[model samples]
Target: MSGPPTASEDAPIRVLLADDHDLVRTGFRAILGVEPGVEVVGEARDGDEAVQQAQRLEPDVVLMDVQMPGVDGLEATRRILGPSSPTSEVRVVILTTFDREDYLFEALQAGASGFLLKNASADDLVEAVRIAARGDALLSPEVTRRVIARFSTPGPAVQPRRPPELTDREFEVLVLLARGATNAEIAGELYLGETTVKTHVSRVLMKLGLRDRTQAVIYAYENGVVAPNGPSRDGSET
Candidate 1:
């Protein structure tokens, strides 16, 4: 898909581009606008404005650049994603050129669900956003394996461990679910029927004491049940 589903053909996937550079926002708007189902709803020059506009417009997604004046991407991400973050569930994807480890970790900790380079292709941008809108982390799909590997440290291997209560199959579903894979997507990936997948997801959610799939994903990371960079649907599975 070009972007998140719009209300109608004439409608568009509402998007907000948050970056410090004028040219950067302009280029993003142009690329996203040309793609079907996508529209640049608004643009912000800094993180403060980004948060303000997010409060006002409540767009479907925020294509946020990591480095900006006043509030940098990391802090902005934290503020917007804070406990008081808008109830609209607006997803934030970091669109930055820096592969700096510090920013990467911070963004993840701050609750950003996806990360992409400034030079990301128009198609990738569109999909990244579309997937994020579904409440899945876009990190594994877009970031390189090197980035994933970096987090897979071996000093005693202390990544979050799988929850003791979850069965193997339940754990698998949890990963896919947290990664934003739909029930059908999880069924295809795990070789189960959609109905079966739903049962497993429901059971997993209950067992994990989670409110929903989004919390499952955050728990998966915080507990190291799945590495932040694990095999996931980048639209690879239906």
Candidate 2:
């Protein structure tokens, strides 16, 4: 199947707002409404509506709230972005007032491309939409630190096994991705051009059947491809 369609550099990013609260949706619409490259295409007051609107509108980015009355944002996200959906390419960014770890992990597992607290500034919200629209995973520094810490805690020692499907270079790319290294950073570390790094990243995701880099990070840790507190690019424990 074809992947999600990429927006042209000059095309405005189409966005959908999914929040139960009218005020919250209004606030988001206001924030994104004035942004030059972002367009608020639709709104959903509940999870069911979110799914319906997502299918109908096919927005490039969905700003989803986790605590809707029914279905909830996580399940709505799954329905919208899961492999079965024709609109799976549509990116969902979980927006919540809660800073709970469970919500963060659940959102990622549901194929959300980003997660942001409602308290985040207007600039952060705008950037989150832009980042997800560009097909990059978005996690705030605080959230990233939490994710790394979760995996970095010492666990029972087990021998690391590289998946046979990946080339050695692909494995290296996965490690850097799990370390929260951006494509540019990976390029610098590996002495490759940015375009080459992007190709490796795409291959890594394709081979692993991952939706995006966020899943790659979880897969690397869960499968023991890279251990917690593993060697960093600088050869020090991360």
Error of 2 at 107 (Å): 0.8
Q: What is the C-alpha lDDT of each candidate?
A: 0.71, 0.84
Candidate 2 contains a number of clashing pairs equal to: 0
lDDT, candidate 1, 43-155, per-residue tens: 99889888888888878788888888898777777887775667235678888665587787677667676787788788898888777765455645334343445445664
Clash pairs of candidate 2? none
Measure candidate 1: CA RMSD.
6.6
Give the winner by TM-score.
2
lDDT of 2: 0.84
Candidate 1 CA-lDDT value: 0.71
